[model samples]
Target: MKEGPNIAAIAALIGDPARANMLQALMTGVALTASELAQEAGVTPQTSSFHLSRMADAGLVSLRKQGRHKYYSLADADVAALLEAMSGIAMRSGMTRVRTGPREPELRKARVCYNHLAGEYGVQAYDSLIAREFLVEEDEKLVLSSSGRSFFTDLGLVLPSNETKRRPLCKSCLDWSARRSHLAGITGTALLSFFFDQGWAKRVEGSRVIQFSKAGDSRFHEAFSLQN
Candidate 1:
């Protein structure tokens, strides 16, 4: 018997089509009820409950109770990161869904990955930060430079002085659609919140797409020094 982690068991849990759909739907970073997840999975409520129970036991998903209603979300950033990495592998392998929609372009342009920005703009942001030396690679890990601290602070983001053991301040996430690295972690989450707070972008209802207004789009490019 293999002594290491049982990846096969976790893979089997995620391998089911209905559960996969439900998990993907939660990638929007919104807590969903079993009924909502059932709709997303295209399964009956009872089936959704069963899958949720299994996932909850496996620590793949977390559940919360709001009054009489129960809501579920991915366990943590690790689960989201795993799903994103898997998506990149699937895309590279040409294992794509046959059904494509008009929103595909929008999704590729800008979308939410868990709690952080992803897609084209997300990739561009990471690239720009690296190019400007705002983020530097050291020992194969991302480190926010002193200049990066000033940059974000000037932009009205409060940078953390000490890194938490539980979550990173700066980390790279693989973008499935752009096929590149994007910012993820506490800083990334803060940046996305800043955009929404400043009205630079807004999340589309019932979807992961982030719609930037015309002025907001211009400002985003200018702020990130993204070439037109």
Candidate 2:
């Protein structure tokens, strides 16, 4: 057999189906309890615990102990990126291209990226800004324009408290499924928060999927011109 990229280590870590599911859940960035994750993977708590323990030992996940509950999340942002990339490859390799039943449209819409927005809506938002010349994309990095500053200012999202406000505004990250660059970095996070503040989106309780209410839907459609 021909050899592949030097990812035997990562391949092994993700090779376990149960561990893979746990990693997918953590990709959403919320710390999930063992039980919640167990349900997600359709495994018993003990099975999930075993998988989580293995992942935690591998440094793929971080474990936190509260007063009682133990919460698990991706070890860091890099871990999330790694998982996303792995998912992208899996999709391209025809690992999960088939869905026998109806797919959940909301999932491919606005969803959490660790702590920010991602998915089709995400791609559209970033694209609209680029189309309008409010944000410039160059070499996968975004530098906000004068109009961008004014845009956010009028939207009521002040610049974050950075010692040097010269930080790059937005960064383009490759979306695993969409095969396009979506927004990331400080600008991306702030804009997501702005959407929430402006009532353009709301988080579904106990879940990371964001659903746009009527006002929010209209606002998002008007602001970014996203196709349903």
Candidate 3:
């Protein structure tokens, strides 16, 4: 493998089913402790920890220690982006959905794609912002305009202190099911947090499933002009 590119190395790192499941569960881009993650991947804590360590070594994830507990998450936005792209390939092969009972419309409607935002809900939000001229796209990345700062400020997010003109406002993430780009990046995370804080969405079972309440439904219609 050359220093510039190593597709085989990356593939080998994510090839294990357990590690793959762990990555999928953390696709929401939030930190989660090993126990919670164990449940998600259907593995024992010790086993999960072993996988976590391997992934952490591979630079696929990162861990933080807090008061005797360690929480794990994707190493960075780049890692999240990789998982989203991989999810797209999985879906293209007709592997994302399972016959595991009923349809999760709420989940399908809105949930975290990776670290940024995704799902039908994320797509709609991104589209609305674009319609309002808050952002523009070049190639695949989303560049924010000055208007974007004002728009986000109105929505109660202060721009990250780390942002630079060349860093970009958001990045396009592939939706596993929708097969389209959704907004993701520092900006997308902010919007998702705002939704939770505003009571527009509630996390279900501490998983990626988010249920929009009636108030949320109304608010989406009002704020974003979403009919559903």
Q: What TM-score number comes out for model 1?
A: 0.98
Q: What C-alpha lDDT do the candidate models reach, one value each? A: 0.94, 0.76, 0.76
Off by over 4 Å in 1: none
Question: Tens digit of lDDT per residue, candidate 1, span 1-228?
Answer: 669998999999999999999999999999999999999999999999999999999989999999999999999999999999999999999998898688999999999999999999999999999999999999989999999999999988997787776689999999999989999989999999999999999999999999999988998998898553
TM-score for candidate 2, please give it: 0.82
TM values, all candidates: 0.98, 0.82, 0.84
For each candidate, how many residue pairs have backbone atoms clashing (under 3 Å)?
Answer: 0, 0, 0
| Candidate 2 local lDDT, 1-228, one digit each (tens) | 868765677678788777887777776778999999998888999999988888888778899999999999998766776776776777788888467233346766777777667888888888887887888856745778888778778767786534233334566766777877778777777878888888788877655578888988787768776433
Candidate 3 on 30-92: residue-level lDDT in tens? 788888888878889999999899889888999999999899988877887777777778879
TM-score leader: 1
By the TM-score metric, which is better: model 2 or model 3? 3
Best by lDDT: 1
User: What is candidate 2's local distance difference test score?
Assistant: 0.76
| Per-residue lDDT of 119 in model 2 | 81
